[model samples]
Target: MSSPSSTPAAPAVDRLRSWLQGRDLAVFHSVANRHWPGADPLLPQLSRSANHGLLWVGAAAGIAAFGSSARSRRAALRGVASLAVASAAINTVGKSAVRRRRPRVDLVPVVRRLKRQPVTTSFPSGHAASAAAFATGVALESGGWGAVVAPVAAAVAASRVYTGVHYPSDVLAGAALGIGAAFALRGIVPTRGQLPAPGRPPGEAPALPGGEGLVVVVNRASGTAPATASLVREALPLADVVEVAPGGLATALTDAAGRGRALGVCGGDGTVNLAASAAATHGVPLAVFPGGTFNHFAYDLGIETVQETAAALTAGDAIRVDLGRFRPGPNGEDGADGYFLNAFSLGVYPDLVRTREHWSSRIGGWPAGVLAAFHVLRGQRPLEAELQGRRRPLWLLFVGNGLFQRVGPAPGRRHNLADGLLDVRVVHGGRTPALRLLAAAVAGPLTRSPAHAAVRRRRVRIAGLAPGTPYAYDGEVAHSGEELTIDKLPEALTVYCPMPL
Candidate 1:
């Protein structure tokens, strides 16, 4: 067996190694070595204690004696029993068969200072195996609490490696064994209760019964947005609040349909896209509550303030909006094309998203915006693009359903969402240049100059673009495709808004 310092053979394994190296694991390992110098000697004995035996047995006993109800007690005991039996069989029988040695004990501080010697072979780490079994069992019992247990198991496994008592691969195998055992056990031990079937599939909306309840779809990560539940309670006291998870927008909408007539979504552009897709399919009137970082969708729709949007929802009126359908190129021959109700662009933006991780870390919004601007300015590059059905070779193309607030006097000034026409704005490289592009962006949305022109078209196609040209639709980059066809789905989506538009 190769040492942990040796390079991984598989591409996926190498990538995972690279990712781990970038995290704080290396520092954490060093700290563990410094604190627990004699930990290596205890690991073999620790592994023999039946894996997560100590934690699980203790928890099961506590729950059985003092749990609130018989159901809770039984669930806890069952989870513990499952993990214990699995851990014992795997650690004793499995490790005995495929005995492997620890990496050089003297290489790390924790191993070198071992007060007592270890006897068992270290191929499959008992510590990790036990942790995995316990965690998987707990996860099967309770999702929210299970999340907490799983990480502790991972940490125990990693500790084995940091202390130089078990090889990384040994811990990996132990984890797999434990997880498999837990899954096998769960097949026999059923969960306490049944959950309702998911209501809606993607692209379909739920049918609202009598149209009185308020359905809220929120992006939990969107900056400082009012909580969707709180907003719903304040604005529509009788409404139901539904939290939508990643890829759960359609289901949320479907579930909401039978409960309420009005649907309110509090999230970023991506959440808006999800709600919009479902609303359009179901012919439901939707309301937007901008909760994302940019609020680009709300901005395009002229819903600037969250308070104002909430007030409008309280008042209750519906409006029909146009939808954009993006048709990607066939055979992967051309750049990706799709319909966006807001704005679509290629270049700088996609690269920015790929690199920006500070958004989650920064407390206030200003820092994130400043960082985004810096990334855009520093990493900006020019790319050639051909508007297949247009007159010029374009550098940057922004297609929108509504007129952007004027950046300056640019050619495409009269873009309107309800006009049944798609607005196309193109920036030429030689005439406008990168500096001009930056200036135009800062000036505002409308740039009326010879270098930029806004043309109205019913259908538009873009092709002959360089590979990897980042195309952002409603702020998220589409996964893959080059050729794009943009067409309008007029009056397809019904939205709730304040009256007098």
Candidate 2:
């Protein structure tokens, strides 16, 4: 009884080790010879591990079992069910049609043991698809947890490569398929449960008479010197127009919500962003009364003039848009949180706010912005910032939920509100001359140009700089030194917008 068939086990283990060694050698050689040294060789390995059916099944089962309430349980089950269906459908219909090959076989292998007899068709990765679907389902049910699930699924899909099973993109496609399927299923089966017997759908107009109650958060220091409160009055009668003291928007919006169906915000991008954040939190739609120096949000949303925004309010066609939530970093206490509706800025823009605040009130916005640009060029240094866990030193960073200014000849092309993604602009700078800074500004909105490529992320984290480094949400500045964590709240706030643009 020394050992039952120890020799046989040794051969199997040796073969497996040999296979793994081959993959490692291939990966090392390919990566070493490549122009870019840091390209990840383990990606394929991780993707292959992700696609194992057992992993997804376990994930679904775990979510379903631990759900607290019946509703929660059902929602969790529905998500898992949806993901499975979607994953299968996408694999059969979408991936099968494409029939792409795995990158590991086509390119290089990091672990040879993980490699197997290559499959003929490999458009999408089943592992990635299943992982994605399950992850998505989990996310929809769990809110912030969904963000976590996606990456876990991504890792699982990556394992496919380590296991010598799928390509990088195959896993990606699978994840997409699974997530899409889950969403489709959720749409079919309402999260709130089934409807009752047929009754006429609610009428298009308001059930109650359109109330005269409106609240306006007017930033007194915004643009061409606070365009007479009288003008705002004429534009919005029956609305309580509160003149917000500098740094009073949060309280003003909370107070306004206690009294109205909609809150109108009058100011620059910063003001609108602040008001919108509050409005979204209170589950109210925001009506824009563009009075800011650079009404970028309004301009992007196609509300060209103050008059147009006012007219839309009169017409009462408000459309809903997404909102973002910002929480303090892990080390901070709870309840030290704020939200933003349009964009969040770090690094350069924050510096601009600090510089601009020092300028006299008589200066116009464009001139102030120009002056700020020059000041930043001459004095401001690029700050080290991290996003979605990736650390990099950057000149400026912007995270926008809905609309953003397009650069070049076309300056105001709007990104749709329903896309469920955040547009991140990272401006890279290195001790460039003042003339070059001016040249960059003259080039138009930095985000759209090739010089300032926008990186999109769902959850963004900024660190490696002092907290008091003045940051603005929309246009209002948060207290200096507050750490910022901005995350997308998809389809959280709804509004009525004019159809057909």
Candidate 3:
């Protein structure tokens, strides 16, 4: 046999790996002997809980269900996405490629050892990766929840070392890897430059001389609360209150704008959309109050309740927001074309909207959406769309005034109010559009499928549609005849948002 000196050289990485492994093994041995008697029950359970990432899965689901806001749901979903990235990396790449051995049971007491020992290589701890990914991911979305879970995640990551399944270095590397995964996903996911900030934006926002000049219109018929008018008056004592019939909001807002120094509307998206037009036309600052089933616009603006909006108005904070203008036919030749404050869509999407309206009162917004999807998907058909002058069949077409986060079947939540880009998402036609949509909902927008596309632009027009095509705009429905035009009115509406978008 050749002398030991004649052996081929090992790569520098391998040498470094070995050196680190040796140093970490000593620490692992020390940790194995230092655990308290209570750890026998706690550490092993933590180890088993993170074995298949079930602990993180439950955490993500809980966050998604905590609030009715789209922001809350999206935050939970993004956390889940981070966990997936970490799990895939640790299993398919980190452990198999590095091939670091797990600590020997001889160093650990028999009672302290994990009941269901892992059989895989332990270069980096999978549990550590999951804990870091979920905690870091959730923190970025919802800070309150993130603060709540951070300590638990840290304890879980440390548990792997105490259990003797992972060296201290293994846990460290796994945490670093998991955090990196979350940052990588942040760019790919719809989070950057989203969420309105507390401040002001450039433009001619009116200075509310005082609450006396502010006119807030209350829609008593809107939302779940029975005392919307009472709430508004109580919140803004000095401001004038106008009560309008649900159907007469437009004319009342037009009449109100002509009379008051500033205009305010406390209602849902449908009422707000109408009020937005009159506010823009009369050059007045419009204050928004959140009093709807799903306050998409106000939520995006960071106003969660009437008192919050009232405080902002009292403080004279306002911002400029973009409005999406749509025309039923080419170049808006049809007089029926109008503007929307939130979102507009066609194809199977419109059907879903219509169905939701029927069941919303009975089942609530989110459940209504689920029920509508099931019924609408059964009879969904592809629509021949002329997008950017390119003809193609599509299952759904969505356009938003500003960039909205894609969380479920529909894109919801705007990050900026005046980015001047219409965020568009398309579901490509497939043999089974409904099933593909369901999968996207379960797996997220980043899931690999040949049927999804996203775009951002200033203008988009669609032609070659069948006459009387179903259309939905900001939760309301209409019929289009063979063609449509969509565009943005840059900084068209001056609204009193609680924060600068």
The local distance difference test score of model 1 is 0.60
Clash statistics: count for each candidate: 27, 54, 0
What does the lDDT read for residue 134 in candidate 1? 73
Best by lDDT: 3
User: Ten consecutive residues with minimal summed lDDT in candidate 2?
Assistant: 198-207
Where is model 1 poorest over a 10-residue stretch in terms of lDDT? 195-204
- The residue ranges of model 2 lying beyond 4 angstroms of the native Cα positions read 1-211, 224-228, 330-335, 403-412, 433-453, 479-484, 495-501
**Residue 155 lDDT (model 2):** 65
Tens-place lDDT per residue, model 1, 444-474, is 5434775665666767777665555677777
Output candidate 3 Cα RMSD: 6.4
For 49-76, candidate 3 gives per-residue lDDT tens digits of 8767788788777776655445566667
- The prediction achieving the highest TM-score against the true structure is 3
Alpha-carbon lDDT, every model: 0.60, 0.60, 0.78
lDDT of 2 by residue, 1-501 (tens): 557667668989999978865775566444433542332545544544444355556655565545322333444565567666865686568766886555544344344334444454666766667777777776665554566567777666655554455544555666677777887876665442222211111112221112256677787877632664557677656667889775787788788866777777777777777676676768776767666655666644555445555565666655555667677774334446676766777767766776776673556444576788778767667776555566766676767774343332222334566456676766666666354334444443434553455555677666555656767776666654434567777766544333333
Better of 2 and 3 by TM-score: 3
